[model samples]
Target chain A: MCPAMGDVDIDSRTWRLLEPAGLTWRCWDDEYIVFHPWSGMTHYLDAIAGTVFELLLDHDATVRGLAAALANQADTPATDSLNVAVRQVLRRFDEIGLAEPIP
Target chain B: MQLGAVPESALRARFRATGVRLRLAGLCINLRTDVPAVIEQILQLYGGYPLEPGAGTDDARVHLKYASPLRRFIGRRTLVFVDGEPLYRPMLLRHAYLMIDSALDWCVSANVTNLVLHAAVAERGGLAVILPAPSGSGKSTICAALVTRGWRLLSDELAVFRAADGRLQSFALPITLKNESIALIRQWAPDAYISPVFTGTIRGDMAFLRPPTDSVTRAAETAEPALIVSPTYQVGAPLALQPLGKSEAFRLLTASGMNYYTTQRFGFDTVAGLVDSCPAWRLSYGTLEQAVDAIEDLLARVRMDPTASRPAITTT
Candidate 1:
């Protein structure tokens, strides 16, 4: 099931979000460039942010799941601080309309 | 057939009645105006451009006419019309040629679907150099200098590139020089023909420099962009070429380009692809001669190794 942003009672494993509609993206080396058609805004995302959007393309995941996947992609350990940073990136994505919490 | 091939009477009559169609770069332009000065300037500067067979599909029509019949006889002002609607304020009749330039720019910027950049573009050795900047940036001055140095003039303004593939469309129009640039280019290329300077226009003093013959003859061809340089002219500052990051380049390009927001993701890909392919730079120069030399040297290195990244250079 999909999860909405800021649901305090929900566990990290149960929430998921979908990629924004009408969005197109391209990559330049390590940087990902995304075009939001509705807002007509272009966003430049670093490795982690890029990974989050790529992960949410067809599959929705929780903050914890995203952190683990990102760490696995980078061949690093998923620590507590890493989870916090991943959560922050997810919140940014929601703010920028790259992804939305499932209502 | 060149516009010069048409008789003077025929040309003037066509302007009053059927409108004269001319092929300019990738677009066909149909211009109509009864102002004698406007016709004279077109015949003088655009004599080399080919005459279009007819104004049909994909053609832009521009008309510079007096606001009223009485105004034509006495008032010293003219209005510019694009397609069927008036688009700009009336300007002094002496600046009729400038009206043509302004009208054509408006038509292209407002209608053309290409990712048009507020830039001056020139090509040499099959490589196109794009200089995108705001007004009064001396872009035209530097562009005129490069043309005198035998660079093929793509345009004095507007670098229209296809979003599908970043190929540049050339519109080899006369370069508009303001204030000191007129004297500088006249001195630099003594053989170059420059129109009489018109003073007190919106841009202060302005003159149109006739484009090179070869550039006009080859306007139909397109070039792949190789370098994107944002230039600024600073008095007494030695020529400096600084490397600009891709992200910054993308921002500047998107900001200067027209219809980027409308094209959205396709526009983003096109601009990002351009930044990724070319080594962008910011150039600041004091003198015209030094700037020309610096650009030529930089273009040589870019042609040799496009991927080579080096430190910025400040030379006197």
Candidate 2:
């Protein structure tokens, strides 16, 4: 079964992009267009989701870690709301087979 | 020699016997049809296109002929054959022109050498503007308007893009206008030549506008894409031209592509390179004049400085 955000321990899990080498993508205007060869689908990701995707491409990260990175990039504090937003993006990424949590 | 120069009797004999060979957008098409209406329409609409030598190999061979004597007598149906195989169900004989037009488009799209999109392409100052939209979205209407206004008609139906260099090859076939647009064009350009309207077909009241002689004569030229516009015609809406981001442009181009999926990675790279090199916009206008003027203005700006016209998109 696919793990939902509510069912998984968000603080203990780290997510990595699925098939990073196979996915082709280009970023423009802070938005991302990705072509997933596995699914044969082209996905458009907005700023937040695109940022999260870019991070996942580089290395694995937890929700809190991603929130901190986003906060640093935007020159803001890693608040509870930011962490919540990052978690939501991660959940969507999981749903789309873009990222999967390590067992 | 052009198709129009051939005498009626000789044309009929050649079409019935050896097929009429014509050059269209750098490809030789050998079409054989005995239907008088199809022949007459070709003589009128394709008068300026160059005729190829009959002895050489052809890229496509098409035949539009009456179905069985019983079917023709009772139903007045015709069949379209590409390479001696029936392409679709028998259509009304009145729609033979439409079937042949669509079959020619299919032949070009089926070609593996070029990536084709369902778009209207025109050129000015050696640069091309691609108008990609769905049917009834005023694509053909706007394309017809632009051609009448002095833009070279690269194509009114398909945008044939060469993947090797990302250039648009010309396919200046006749512009197929449907329903109200036929009268609209006739009223707008009184001197334009339009075929007799074939009523009660599947596309609903269709007619074709003969492409300009200059476009037909210069069919071998290719133009680099300078701008991409997705147009929409809304009744009573004011003219609006909005800058489109590259990602969105890529999405639109790929969505409109006729054989993008089959072309695979080459399609991806070529489309990406096109969006990178050219700027794109979303154009909506109630009046044709406004859209044409806005496009001309954009083209002027692009000619002046292409970098400034492109939408500012900084990679993350």
Candidate 3:
């Protein structure tokens, strides 16, 4: 049986974008709109989610690493609240097939 | 020759016998009908449109005919057909004009090779403003008002965008006015020709406003898209115009497209390119005059500096 989502430690897992090459996207004013080729769906991402998606495009990262990077970009401290928010965004991305977690 | 130039007797006979082929925005539509009311309305409204030459083939063949005697006896019904296939169940005879108008709209929507959008389009000095909105959003009313103020009507129902070139083709058909808009437009432009109102129809009291002669004469012209505006009409509300974000504008456009999914990558690329080049805004107004003034101001601004109208993009 698959492990419960709560039991899987998000910080210990790394996430990556799904089929990065096939996805078409455009960014304007820090907002991003992406079109997935396989599902033929278009998605709109706000600044935070957009930053996360752009980061994942370069390489895989854990929840902690993404939070640190986001903090550096915003010039703020990487707090636990920011980590929680990043984890939530990753969960959403996974649900929408935009990103997946490595086992 | 224009349909109006055809003698009345010949027009009726052709409509009855062999179908009158009309050239509408680069499409050949062969319309056949025996119903007198439908024919009269077509002649009154489409009189300015040119007729196809030399018995050329048609892109869409539409027939609006009276129902069989049995069906008529049951309830004075009429049937609508496209390319030898019935499009809908028999409608009431009084609703024959609505049936034919909808059939012609279907012919344009189905037959076009370009990306079709459920939007109203108008142009000034070769720059087109696309208003992408759903029905009852005051798009048609705004479009008609713009026409009265000397802006050419590209289309009041569909915005046809060529995929290869990203230019908007003119589909200048009649502007449909609903309920209160009929009187509003009539008062606004007293000289404009309007059809008799069809009361108590499915859309509830609708009429067709004949397109201006100049617009019909320039049916071959295409315009570069310069602005995208999504309008909302609210009674007793002040005029409010706000710059729309590019991502939101892209969403609104793709949502308004009739064949976005079918067009796929082309649809995505076309809409993205529009968002990249054109400035988009959300406009809400109470009165026709206010909307017209605001749009004119926007047009002037865009005409002066197209790049200045786009919302400033800053990294967050």
Candidate 4:
């Protein structure tokens, strides 16, 4: 079931995210280890965080959509906690140049 | 034909004229030196390696000679040249073999595309056991012991891992014994071929044990990783081997591997696969005997029960 998200900013709703160009990644047991060539940093990501990047790689995804994608991967319904986690992970991705939220 | 198959006269003539090219495992080295002791060391230490038959480009070109006429006679110093450029400071002329070892180390660590880790490697049953530790942690000492105990030596200084298949490539160079280890190995394995100790080298009283013939013969073989053990030698400490988690193993490998960050995501995947496929542990031991025994026991257990060491990975 999808919940109403009138309170959340539109910027977080329709924000387009994608992996940085030339980034590399590997996954083990659903956990992702990603390397950012520009920054020369290796990040360890849990299953949910990994799903977020995978979802964005195919097409631009919004926060709500990202949460839904993660839920689908895990074979569960999207929860409020999943949405909050997605938002936090996206902020981290932005800082690391892993993904950009474009207009 | 192997280097040993070539007569000393032919090797000497080759060394004096063009260079003596020796192929060891995946690397080919063309060495040019006329120094009698250096030549003797090469013929003696590298006797088991195959002679590079002018087939492909040599991976490294190293030349060792007296620094200058003045220094050659005065301090008796030698300079190491790689690709026609002097790469290291002049050291005692007697340190020519050390220069060769150092030059080869530089060549592979800087040039090879594989992810290089400063570790010792040995293989048994087609599985490589990687011992990645900082220098002076008794890595070579233990590695030499294992080789003497009939384990095939993959490498004593560098563990080169290919990213495509996550397998360890054999680099069966000599096992260097340093300082106290020099006397220790001689006493432990009297039959081992050890070079005469050269004092005043950078590492202090360094000697190299020639790699076994079997290891040199199988240098082209590659082995998938089965175990990664980080050793810390302590005096009077009881032998202890503790399980190291996968995340921690990945962290340690990234820290020690030279090209780990440069290879980016491929490097991450290579190491991740290695960690997931093998069980890692931290081993602490006081005596060489205890360490060897423990490692052999671990190998036996893993052989009997393959799944005991495999880490669990959740695909969903």
Candidate 4 residue lDDT tens string, B187-271: 8789999999989866778999998899999888898788888888887888887877777787788888877877766777788
Q: Any runs in candidate 2 off by more than 4 Å, and if so which?
A: A1-14, A18-23, A37-40, A71-103, B235-237, B311-316
State, as a TM-score between 0 and 1, how close model 4 is to the true structure. Answer: 0.81
DockQ of each: 0.40, 0.41, 0.54, 0.31
Tell me the tens digit of each residue's lDDT in model 1 across A1-103. 2245553422244334444566767665667778887678888888888888788775888777888898998899999887777777777776766665554
Name the TM-score of candidate 1.
0.85
Question: Model 3 over residues B66-172: C-alpha lDDT tens digits?
Answer: 77957656778999999999999998888898989899989988888778888999999999999998899989999999998898999998889987798999999
Among these predictions, the greatest DockQ belongs to 3
The lowest-lDDT stretch of 10 consecutive residues in candidate 4 chain A is A1-10
- As for TM-score, the candidate ahead, 1 or 2, is 2
The alpha-carbon root-mean-square deviation between model 1 and the true structure, to one decimal in Å, is 3.9
Where is model 4 more than 4 Å wrong at Cα?
A: A1-17, A20-32, A36-40, A45-91, B54-57, B310-316
Please report, as a residue range, the 10-residue window in candidate 3 chain B with the lowest summed lDDT: B307-316
Give per-residue CA lDDT, model 1, range B1-316, as digits (tens): 9898989998999987878988776677898989888999889888988898855664688988987888877987889888888887887788878889888767656666877778999999889889988888889999999998899999888888876677988878889999988888899999998989989987889999989888999987788888887888888888888887777787788888767877767677788778878878888988889888878887888888877643245343
Q: For every candidate structure, what is the RMSD over all alpha carbons to the true structure, in angstroms?
A: 3.9, 3.8, 3.4, 6.0
Clashes of each: 1, 0, 0, 0
